[model samples]
Target: MPLPDGNNFIEKFAKSFYNLFDTPATIIKEKIVAPNQKTYPWYHQKFRRVPTIDQCYTDDPICVFEADMQYRRDRQVDSEILSILRQRFEDCVLYETPDHMEKCKHLLQQYEEGSTDWFTKYGDLGAYHDVKVAYMKQKHRMVWERRHGPVGSGMKEN
Candidate 1:
């Protein structure tokens, strides 16, 4: 049925305002997902799927920030190792191959066996413990800089 004609200016204004803001029942119904009473593949049902990285970008800001930080940290660690290796070996070409893979395997074995003479066995390319300590210090500095707007910025460390 058609709405009754407004009797006065106040009624007309009220009707107009209600019409502007009121949502149709059909539209609200369309938004609601009714639970499936029967298990059927053809029926419309809400299915939960794992969120992709693109979805995470908009959905979780903290997760995205943490992932970016981890990526940067890993890149810095790799760069440090490469820089040290290049400084020690002038003509060394670092590439992954079966031989290199075997060398890594052997190194891991030696490390697990409590051998600390890796530099003697594999040339003077610095100790693994020293490299790890340096990486951790660098990473700590990067995190501190990010949180406190860089060192020497008049921000006293506490």
Candidate 2:
């Protein structure tokens, strides 16, 4: 009989191995003594810099309130901009046909080859922006794959 996919074999092996030692490993780990919380690196690095609620009380409470309100407004504006960009990015990817993808790739090549005004040549700003974003995302993926091997090669997860 023909063998199943390679992933199936690996999954089966992993499951069998886990089943064999899962209980014993848990028992051993639980029985071992854990180090003091103060000795842990993250405990000192994270907690030492944070101020408690009582520590935040100040003589000029109005200034603190105003500062907090400004901070919240800035965060809200940032979140709105991020949401817009995400929508644009998704629309660019979702609506791209194979021909459009190829054109975007060619435009990227032209831009890389000293045609700095490639976007202006496209006329429509929305189309130009979408193509540029798609090209950059593709380039990023290519570079990542080159550095770390193909997806699911046991180096990085999906």
Q: Which predicted model would earn the best TM-score?
A: 2
Ten-residue stretch with the least lDDT total in model 2: 114-123
Backbone clash count for every predicted candidate, in the order shown: 0, 0
Kindly list the per-residue Cα lDDT of model 1 for residues 3-60, writing each as its tens digit. 5677678888998778776756545555653442345577555333343223355567
Best by lDDT: 2
Error of 2 at 29 (Å): 80
How do the predictions measure up, each by TM-score?
0.23, 0.28
The positional error of residue 49 in candidate 1, measured at the CA in angstroms, is: 23
Superposed model 1: Cα runs more than 4 Å off: 1-57, 91-158
Off by over 4 Å in 2: 1-58, 99-158
Cα distance off (Å), candidate 2, residue 15: 94
Residue 41, model 2, lDDT: 52
lDDT string, candidate 2, 7-111, tens digits = 587788988888798977776666654432235555433322233223345575654554444434443455555555555544554667555565455444433
